[model samples]
Target: MSEVAFRLFAERGFDNTTVEQIAAAAGLSRTTFFRYFGTKEELVLGRVGEFGREIADALAARPAGERPWEALRRAFDVIAEPRPGETGAPMDIIRLLSDACALMTRQWEKTQGWQSMLVPEISRRLGGPGPATDMRAGALVAAAISCLDAATDAWTAGGGVVSLADLTDQAMGVLREPGDVPG
Candidate 1:
């Protein structure tokens, strides 16, 4: 259903596309579509929620002794390293989201949601929360997400001329800077 929505969103502008159209294209009833996705925005950005969980789970699964920054880098690496035949979803979604003001706003909201979910888990992994621990967790998560954002932005701007995984690795490498030491 999402892939169908993605293709429709790409072929027809996001604003021009409708739930009814997406439902029809996917051969699902509008009722079924509603059962799956509450809003068109949710349908479009659904993978983001899954990615958020993936990052959190990846972080949680890392060696307990790993530094917070290093764990985050590894967590992000999970998503940054694409599987086979997975080249186009992000580019298409980025293009679609870039053009739509609503989705862009929702994107920001979604990111904050992801960050909120990460903070406590990060704090836990760093030996539980204090003001300092919470602050570090928040900052690290923000920086990691920013690295991904910058990499994706660059990828989109360059028409995907460079590998996104490499870009992500480069961007994320900044976290290793000595100045990025967490509390």
Candidate 2:
């Protein structure tokens, strides 16, 4: 279903494509399409929300004693790796989302949603719950997401010539610097 939708989105352009078109292309009924996806946006960006859970789960799978920031970075390695049956490259999906104004806004919302899924584990790594730990966890999650956005923006601007995982690590690494941000 997604492969069909993605190909259509890629070929026809996301804004130009319609749910009915996607359904017909995939040989599914409109009702069946609605059963599977609520909207055209869902067909494209649905996996995004799921990636939050995957990242959180990845964080959980890291060594118990790993540093919080390091664990988070390792967790994101799962994201840089292509999905089992993804129809587009990570760069292609980034381009797709950037092409549509509404999806870009929704992507921001969905990415922000990752914080809630991540805070508990981060807090645990910060030595369990408390005002300081919770606050720190929230900040760390925000910082991590910011690093991802920075990496993504860089990737888009640089023609995706660099591996996104490497760019992400570079963004995260910049934060670990003891000196001011490089100009």
* Every candidate's lDDT: 0.78, 0.83
Give the per-residue lDDT of model 2 (tens digit) for 29-141: 99999998899898767778877898999999999887888898899877665555557555567878878887998999999999999988888877756534578788888
Estimate the Cα RMSD of every predicted model relative to the unseen true structure.
Answer: 2.8, 3.6
Best by TM-score: 2
> Where does model 1 exceed 4 Å of error?
86-92, 130-133
- Name the Cα RMSD for model 2: 3.6
Worst 10 residues of 2 by lDDT: 174-183
Worst 10 residues of 1 by lDDT: 82-91
Which candidate number would show the highest lDDT if scored against the true structure? 2
lDDT of 1 at 62: 85
lDDT of 1 by residue, 1-183 (tens): 887888887788889999999999999899999998899998778876777888888888989888887787788765566566553355566777777888887887776778876787778766656524577778878887898888877877787778777888788886677756663
